[model samples]
Target: MNHNQQSTDGIHEDDAALSEFLASLMDYTPTIPDELVEHYLAKSGFQCPDVRLIRLVAVATQKFVAEVATDALQQCKARQTTVVKDKRDKQQKYGVNVKHQEYFADSPSTGMDPASRDE
Candidate 1:
């Protein structure tokens, strides 16, 4: 194979392109959710297990993390937007600065106990 020849991929990547790709990979960190981690661990089906098995699970999960994260982000945004919309709807329905008297119910003590005072 010639040094400057185009590889099977069809595009001839120079050293700079390869270097840039490698550099980008260095900064690439997959954001896997805790739920996925738990699911993977549970699917492995073991107590105090082998390191190789753990590594295998991690490697397998790495491929799906990007897709999972993208979907999770979309769901999160939808949930948050719904919550905000619900809050606004409630506020509008009840009127602005609405305060329930039950929330400010009478308390037993103001600050200190009655017997503790040096009166």
Candidate 2:
């Protein structure tokens, strides 16, 4: 096929896919209610009488919120994992030294009471 024919075919395929997606949107119910979407749209001074367009807006908003929530959850989990890892690393690196210091500080051989050391 010529380059022009190939480009034309690609455009047709894209149009078909977009039509299919729009058709599917008719049957798909978004998590965000249509009433809420319509109310918000109306409040924002946007007027659309078509139910399909409202539904499309609702679906898009739902998808955007879901994506943002998923990203936030992933970031929270990653931050928690990093915090836990850092704590474990610090403990592993200093656990023995801390314990040893406590032991020696309280030892009778030191002849210095732990409470007096603070003075």
Candidate 3:
């Protein structure tokens, strides 16, 4: 097929898919209620007589909110993980230093006997 014909076919396919999607919206209930969406839309001075369009808007809003909430949760979890890792690193460093100090304080080469040091 010619390039122009191919482009025309693609547009027709897209239109068919869009129509199918809008029809499917009627069967699906969004997390955000239709009444709530209508109320807010009316408040915002937006008017649409089509229920499918309202449902589409509601589904889109629900998806946007869910994505934002998920991102925030992920960031919170990542920050918590970072904090736990830092605490563990600090404890490991301090524990190693404490062990080294104890080893040196009791070593015979340091000219200090363990019993004398304890006293």
Candidates in order have lDDT scores of 0.61, 0.88, 0.91
Residue by residue across 1-119, what tens digits does model 2's lDDT show?
A: 69999999999999999888888888988889999999999999999988788999998898899999999999999999999999999988876554443444445447767688677
Give a tens-digit lDDT track for model 3, residues 5-108: 99999999999999999999999999899999999999999999899999999999998999999999999999999999999999988664444434444455
For each candidate in turn, the TM-score is: 0.31, 0.68, 0.76
Query: Model 1 residue 43 lDDT?
Result: 75
For residue 73, model 3's alpha carbon misses the true position, in angstroms, by: 1.2
Q: What is the lDDT, from 0 to 100, of the residue 53 in candidate 3? A: 93
Off by over 4 Å in 2: 1-9, 96-119
The 10 consecutive residues of candidate 2 with the worst lDDT sum are: 97-106
Task: Order the numbered candidates by lDDT, best leading.
Answer: 3, 2, 1
Cα misplacement distance, residue 59 of candidate 3 (Å): 0.8
Report the Cα lDDT for candidate 3. 0.91
Q: List the residue pairs that clash in candidate 3.
A: none
> For every candidate structure, what is the RMSD over all alpha carbons to the true structure, in angstroms?
17.3, 7.3, 7.8
Q: Residue by residue across 1-119, what tens digits does model 1's lDDT show?
A: 67445573445456667566545544444345434555667777754344334444444577677679899999999999999999999988977666665544256454557786544
> What is the C-alpha local distance difference test score of candidate 1?
0.61
The regions of model 3 sitting more than 4 angstroms off are 95-119
